[model samples]
Target: MSVKSYRQALNEALHQEMARDPHVIVIGEDIAGGAGASGQQDAWGGAFGVTKGLLGAFGPARVRDTPISESAFVGAAVGAAATGLRPVAEIMFVDFLGVCFDQIFNQAAKFRYMFGGKAVTPFVLRATFGAGTRSASQHSQALYPIFTHIPGLKVVIPSSPYDAKGLLTQAIRDNDPVIFLENKLLYDTVGEVPDGPYVIPFGEANILREGSDVTIIAFGRMVHIAMDAANALAKEGIDCTVIDPRTTSPLDEDTILESAEETGRVVIVDEANPRCGMAADVSSIIAEKAFGALKAPIMKVTAPHTPVPYAPNLEAAYLPDATRVAAAARAAFTYGK
Candidate 1:
């Protein structure tokens, strides 16, 4: 019943999870900052200061500070996870994924499948993603698609503070490896999050707003945009339903197909690029399962295929905003109606 920033929610979840389980360890580059430095050992508390107070409470043993080497530290996290530790490693930016993709996709993600369901790698890789902070091409990217493309990995994009807390907790407890994406732009964003421990089951689509005319399916921060668009559409006497499938890997196909069938109109708002991404994936799911119910072709509101631009104006235009999502939903509703 209290409001908290998205970052605080994440911090709280990590704190609570660590308190609940001794095996849950946090390893990352300067996560506790000043790791081996003389100036205040916990000075940095992470690049953006998300883990500020963690070192003081949990100490350096549980809250580790790793070298700049992503492969070594991240690979160590993966190896530790297989050996009975629930390691939550922060990759800082999703862009840095290239350095450690092999460990995730080939090792952690494939452990269970490769071993014929004998292995269980309970690990979480949290990274900041999306464009809005003018972090340029390398630091800012909506790279969920790359993770989504891989098998045995559960991908999560939490749009709000509440979802961030719940989904991250769920990811930590799950048996398989999970890639949790936090939109760098939404760190300061505030929302209500429960204080106690709770876990949101994956593969379940949350229908935030119900409507009769159109179904707007979204993920991560796009879910917030779709909700904004739904509110704007209401003024025009057009009702819209917004659905967020918290986890992309175990996608809730049943909820999506049902929503598509019920509304007979679908608009997918994804922060990722338009090509072979979440947008295309969800559109195809509805197209294949509920094609007959569609009164019009499915619509997708997504970023251009180009890499996230650095310029403020270009970045603003490149990222799909509330207006774009609303317009897309309006078009989908009108075209079908």
Candidate 2:
């Protein structure tokens, strides 16, 4: 198989899904640019050019462009999903979820439960998220927990190129609405992805490295950081098993709890805030379900409970890095005093 970047893998997934299902359609701003302008059509092909050749391949009906209104387009996407089509809408920045939360949380997320499991919204909302890029508070935010708290929606935070493609395909095909958060920094990160269509089940936690010393649970880009720490920790004889729970909503709590029980220690790395975040949620799970398997108090490496800062230094500090993840792992490994 060819080595492809995370961004390319996602693009390929969209291309494959669109080709496979006539019901699967993409809608968002400038998905295929120059709709009414004098310039050539399909000019932009998405803000990051992920949907570049889709317009040429599928034509305008499938690869659609919408106005700069998150509510209108996102609402329309939810409606279309409820009707029959599996729509993949690009919200640009997840920070823009503010304008469309009503449609997402109120409508799409609650439809199945509200309708007594009669309605199925097979929709995927792909949006760029996380700090870095210096886009500031308004643009950069790792807001996964908010969606995770919702019952009827599935939240996917894929850390690698392979996961990106597989999880995205699953999201498009699944009966529930999914919020697929792609880190901007990870767009260029390269990895091997299957050429053919494949699916990664939501509740399965992938153990990146199996170790007995400590278990590190992470999601999205934080998984990479935890894996980095595990690689370095292995040198010092502190082996860490890194688990990426691909989808936060379906959560794979069984796998996480089982790993925690086996290792007797856990370090959770989350890119979001400390309070009421995924780190806290996992820590609580380990505490309740596998409390007897505690070799050390659970450690959480996460951003502070504050808005993402504008400055590069603060932003870097705000985001959990490999160094921070390593320190947390060290704490868990060295605990017992």
Candidate 3:
């Protein structure tokens, strides 16, 4: 294993997977670069450069550049997956999914069940999410909860480079439509990742830290914020456990319930709006199953039920941070004591 940024890890995963399986193909806007725009293969590499070097290795047939149309290309990817190829379609930003969501939720997500288990759509829809860099409301939003709400779509949100590479490999291999979201703030963060491709199974939560006072569950870049909160709380005598539910669809309810029962107080942190979001979903799960072990009402630290703001200060305030997470965890930690 070697240290790699989240972008490098994602690039490596695409390289390894395409080489291993000829059926794997990539279709996205400006992914393979384009004419008169840096003018060569792997030049642009999508909006964030995660798909860099794919064109040089896989060629045009496998690494394709589609027109600037989310609906057309995403629909094409779904159709391609249904026919035979395993297509990894990149949607630049998750906000653009509104244009092609039916293709994802209706067509790609329903093939296998509609065909009575004979059909398989091995499609991986990769998109960048989260609020940072002042992309404004149109570009920065956490929409994983909507994908998770869908019945057949498998949702993945990796918090680190190690998790990104392994979980992405797993998505490419899995025989179902997968929505893999990469947080915009996490692409530059570096971590140790294996050189060879690896797969981390779905429904497995990564317990970043173990403590007894309270359990903090988070998603995507929020996981790091939760980790920071845990470390800070440890100094104040409020030990905490941080869990990252890697795939929200096949959510590791077992791990979450076990941790909630063990601590008897739970705090869920989500970057999305609190209404009908991951925070609410997880809070409901804990309340429904682990209520008997609870020492206090379950707490959810999430963004306000509004769109992400454009101003830097408001944007910062709109997203959940370590201080807020620590505050929530501390509240839960000392509720009765």
Candidate 4:
């Protein structure tokens, strides 16, 4: 095991996968910087430098850069995947999905089902998401819920470097279209990761902290936030279990229900807007299936239903933090008691 940053983990995953499978290729804007310029190549390595060394290792044929048009390249990725290439296309930011929604939600996502189960679109759409860099409203939205809502797309959000490496490997190997959303703020966060390639199975909820008082279900970057809250809650004799549903699409409802039933209280923390977000969806699942087990009402701590603010203070307020999560857990623990 080695301690690595989330960005390094993702970069290593892409490198390992490309080396293992000849069919695996990468396509995105500035993925291989200095496409035709006089300067050095592989300059940008993507907007976050996650795809940096790939161009040198894989060469231009596999690590191809594309125009800024999301529709054309994303559509091309869909075509390439249908033609037997495992393409990992980077979208720069999740908010840019608006320009190429049809290619993802309609084309790549529906190929297998629409073709009588004969098509295998082994495509991974990697995008930087979440609000912490203060990239403003257009670039910082946590839009994982939008992809999670779609049927044919598999969504994976890893909160740590270890999960990022394992889950990206799985996403590349899977025979279905996968939306791999990476929280921009977590790119620099470091965690222990295996040296060689590994895969973390989807739909498995990882229990970060086991507790008896309440259950906290968090996704992506919010997982760390939940952990912070759980640690703080532990001091006040209110132990809490934090579950990270690694893959949002094939959600680990069983683990969620089990924890909810055991704790008899739940506080869902999501970075996305409250309406129709993962927090609401998870709350509904617990309310419907584990209603009798619940001792207190389910509390949801999420971002407001508004665009991410540009100002640092407003952005901080817009995003759910450890303080809010701890408060929600306290509320759940004290309800009706």
Candidate 4's TM-score: 0.98
Q: Model 4 Cα RMSD, Å?
A: 1.7
lDDT of 4 by residue, 291-317 (tens): 999999999999999999999999989
What lDDT does model 3 reach? Answer: 0.92
Which of 1 and 3 is ahead in lDDT? 3
The list of candidate 4 runs beyond 4 A from truth reads 33-38
Q: Which regions in candidate 3 have their CA more than 4 angstroms from the true location?
A: 34-42
Encode model 3's per-residue lDDT on 1-337: one tens digit a residue.
Answer: 9999999999999999999999999999989853233455536878889888788777889988988999999999999999999999999999999999799999999999999999999999999998977999899999999999998899999999999999999999999999999999899999999999899999999999999999999999999999999999999998899999999999999999999999999999999988999999999999999999999889899999888899999999898999999988888888988
- How high is the CA lDDT of each candidate model? 0.88, 0.91, 0.92, 0.93
Winner on TM-score between 1 and 2 is 2
Task: Give one digit per residue, the lDDT tens place, for model 2 in 255-284.
Answer: 999999999989999889888899999999
Q: Give the TM-score of candidate 1.
A: 0.96
How does residue 61 of candidate 2 score in lDDT? Answer: 90
Per-candidate TM equals 0.96, 0.97, 0.98, 0.98
Q: In candidate 4, where is summed lDDT lowest over 10 consecutive residues?
A: 33-42
For candidate 1, write residues 1-337 as lDDT tens digits.
Answer: 6899999999989889999999999999878843343466647878877777777777779889887999998999999999999999998998998988789988998899889998899999999988888898898888898898888999998888888898999998999999999988789999888889888888888889999999999888888888988999999998998999888888899988998999999999888888999999989988888988998889899999899899899999999988988888878888834
Displacement of the residue 87 alpha carbon in candidate 3, Å: 0.4
Error of 2 at 330 (Å): 1.1
Give the TM-score comparing model 3 with the true structure, all chains together.
0.98
Tell me which of candidates 1 and 4 scores higher on TM-score.
Answer: 4
